[model samples]
Target chain A: MTPIVKPLIKTEALTKTYGSIIAVDNLDLEITEGEIFGFLGPNGAGKTTTCRILTTLTKPSSGHAFVSGFNVVEEPVKAKSGIGVVPQYLNVDGELSAYENLKLHGMLHGMEWGKMKMHIEKMLEFVQLSDRASSLVKTFSEGMKKRLMVARALLHEPKVLFLDEPTVGLDPQTRRNIWGIIRRINQERATIFLTTHYIEEAEVLCHRVGIIDYGRLIALDIPEQLLKRTGRFVVEMLDDDRSKARFFKNREDAGRFVASLDRDAIIRKSNLEDVFIKLTGRKVID
Target chain B: MVGTYAIFWREMVILRRRLIRVMASYAISPLLFLIAFGWGMGRSLQVEGMDYLTFMIPGLIALSSMSQTFSIAMDINISRFYWMTFEEFQTAPISSSSIVLGEVLSGMVRGMLASFIIFILAAAFGIRLNVNWALLLSVIFNTFMFASAAVITSMIVKSHADQASFNGFFIVPMSFLCGTFFPLSRFPEWAYLIAQVFPLTHASSCIRAAALGMDIPLISFLVMIIYSILFFLGAITCVKKASL
Candidate 1:
């Protein structure tokens, strides 16, 4: 007989509303330990609100959330001790050195001085920020600041790390660099709860992906499975004043359809964007 | 407790970086006031049975304590609106009360540092009065009350323009009309009643009595204590609401 294993994160019929508009409606989810779960959504799609709720930054209007076996609303401090969140905005204090910022965070976390110092050093090295440890954060570039944010979030070694659009605004090379950091952290057995609108990021980093639209969870599956379900190939061509996308199960079939068309056409493998459009019967994200 | 210390330590680190500018802020204003008043008209005037300089020093201390402590609101606003660094406190495992207490403690330190500079200026002008435990108590209560008020205002404000409006309407009026330069006896009855409603008025009276070695007004102390506790609670509530 096998014992039941509790998921690291769970939400039960979670709902949130602001006046007449609902932000999140009856979300139910379970993320097992040691898995990278990606929440993908466009702007105003409720991804941020869900992340905020799980990180204990916002309370759900009704329903339950648990992180690391502690109820978020009932035991926020206990739940927060197990969670680390890198918010969408850059919040590192420009007045302090990178080391000082991490030191402040550790102190607020109530970490012992010696242990906190050691972890701060390790995190700086991990983020490749050890060389600029004493430099004020305002002097750092955007990529460097983003790295420092990651180091600060990981300082306490939280059991679950929530990265909200970790690579939202960065060069392609820098975005890849962050992906390596995310992958390495997951290899260390920390559960990663990532929220991003970048479809490629979810495909590359997530073990399972949940796509939300208009404050609802529309799809949850492995990226490959989702793409498979939506068809594997796409042929997009000019149709009147707008471009129309058609999905096919096989590249050969897609090629045959493209040949039959009399207009300029492009054939490509289906991605999360196509899946989102297919599931919602709407155009891909803006 | 650790949360409070961490918050205090963060402010101290930032303060230390701008030590020269901060020291000048503490020294320059009180020096100008002392030179203008004590070396000018205060050289010959007398008020309330004491030398004008003596009468003025305690009021200056009270003013310095209130202004410097309440300057914490500026720091909190910069953190909130520009840096967004206040969210670090919100996201951390610390309680809202701890955050308020921590910020208030740092503000008190700033206020007391400014008061110490005022004492030095007073001494340089040959206007030393005995510094006693009651004086310490008065300054503490004053700083605590204003610091709590600073947190509440910082949390409630939505923008930098709103902060300027708050200072203009609330702090600026109190600074000028709250008996910081003259006695409430100088005002007409209704005017005095309006002035008396401000906590700064009681703070000025309490600090003046404690510093001048006069018969202290126990009622002033009671008024300050009530304002301090109420403002502290309000600060905590404001912080919690801001996070939400």
Candidate 2:
């Protein structure tokens, strides 16, 4: 018999309410070590709220959360020590250089001076900001600022990292660069919990994606399996300003479906966005 | 403690980078006040036993410390709204107490720097008085009181304009009427009662007494201490509340 490994991050019936509105409702989740879990949701879908609760930035209205086996609410300092958070907005210290920003984060985590110096160098190199280490953050491009934020979050080598919309508003090349960094970090066996509304981002980077809607977890599975829930292939018919889609069990069926349509239609593999639309009756970016 | 120092260290780095700007800010107003009030008006008039410049030096120190400490509110607002750096501290393992302490200490440092600028300006005007430990302690207390107040106001105000309005409504009036320009005895009886309510009044009284080589009144020291404690508590409460 094999023993079951406990999850590195777990939440039991976690909920948060702002007066009459429930931001997160009866949420239950478990993410094991080394797993890259992506939280997919639309605007106001409580993705950031869950991250806030798990990261110990805000208290849950009820229930509990644990990060690296430490209860977030009860042992917030310890939980915070184990988890690193990169918020959605660019929160870098603009007055300080890239190296100084990372160094400040390390010092806040109580890293020894010798270790901090080495870690700052390593992080600057990891994010490809080594050349800009001495430059103030205000002078950096938006992409560079995002990379610096990632470096700051990872400076302490945390066991779990929470990235909230890490690559939002970046150019395509920069977004892909950030994706490569996230994949490289996950390859080192650090659990990553990311929340993003970018459907392609979740499809390409996340091992398992959780779809949330109206403050509820609507679906949870691997991207392939979730896509399978809708169908194996998609037939999209483009109109003047709108598009309609149909799902089928196989490529042949999808091709037939496209042929039967009078308008121009295209057949392709189903993706996480299809799953999200099927589950929530709305587009991910709507 | 490491976290607290980290916060303070970041402030120091920025201060170092903007050293010229900070020095100018500290020096310009006090220079103007000395020129207009002490050099221009005080050369002819005598209110107390000493020259007007001597009497106004302590008041200027108290007023400068108050304004410098209250300027922390603008820094906090900028960090919270524009840069969002306060969220970095919020998500770290640092305690609320450490954040408050670090910010208040930075405010105190600025307050003392502004006082020292005024001191140099006073000397340039040929007005020198006996600066003692009591005078230093009074300035420290005054700074702590206003710094804590700044933190509270920063948390409560929704916008930078709101913070400016707070200065316009509260700090501006206090600067002029808190015995910073003249003695409270010059005010009418009802006005004197109101002036006594401002913490800067006690600070000005204690600083002037100490600078003149006179005995510092125990009650003024006690009042300043009590106000510092209350404002410090209020600041901590606001920090915790804002984090939520």
Question: How high is the CA lDDT of each candidate model?
Answer: 0.90, 0.90
TM-score of chain A of each: 0.96, 0.95
What's the DockQ for every one of the candidates? 0.71, 0.69
For model 2, report DockQ: 0.69
> How well is each residue in B1-244 modelled by candidate 1, as lDDT tens digits?
7779899999999888987899788889888888888888756787888778888889999998899999999889989888889988888888889999999999999999999989888888888777899999999999999999999999999988899899999998898789887778999999999997899999999999988887679999999999999999999999877764
- CA lDDT, candidate 2, residue B85: 89
**Candidate 1 residue lDDT tens string, A1-286:** 9978789999999998998888998999999989999999888889899999887778788989899998888887788887788888888989999999999999999999999999999999999999999999999998999989998998988899999999988999989999999999999888999999998999999999999998889999999899999899999998887888999999999999999988899999999989998888764467
Name model 1 segments beyond 4 Å from true: A281-284
Report the poorest 10 consecutive residues by lDDT, candidate 2 chain B.
Answer: B42-51
Deviation in Å, model 2, residue B58 alpha carbon: 0.6
Query: What DockQ class does candidate 1 belong to?
Result: medium
For DockQ, the strongest prediction is 1
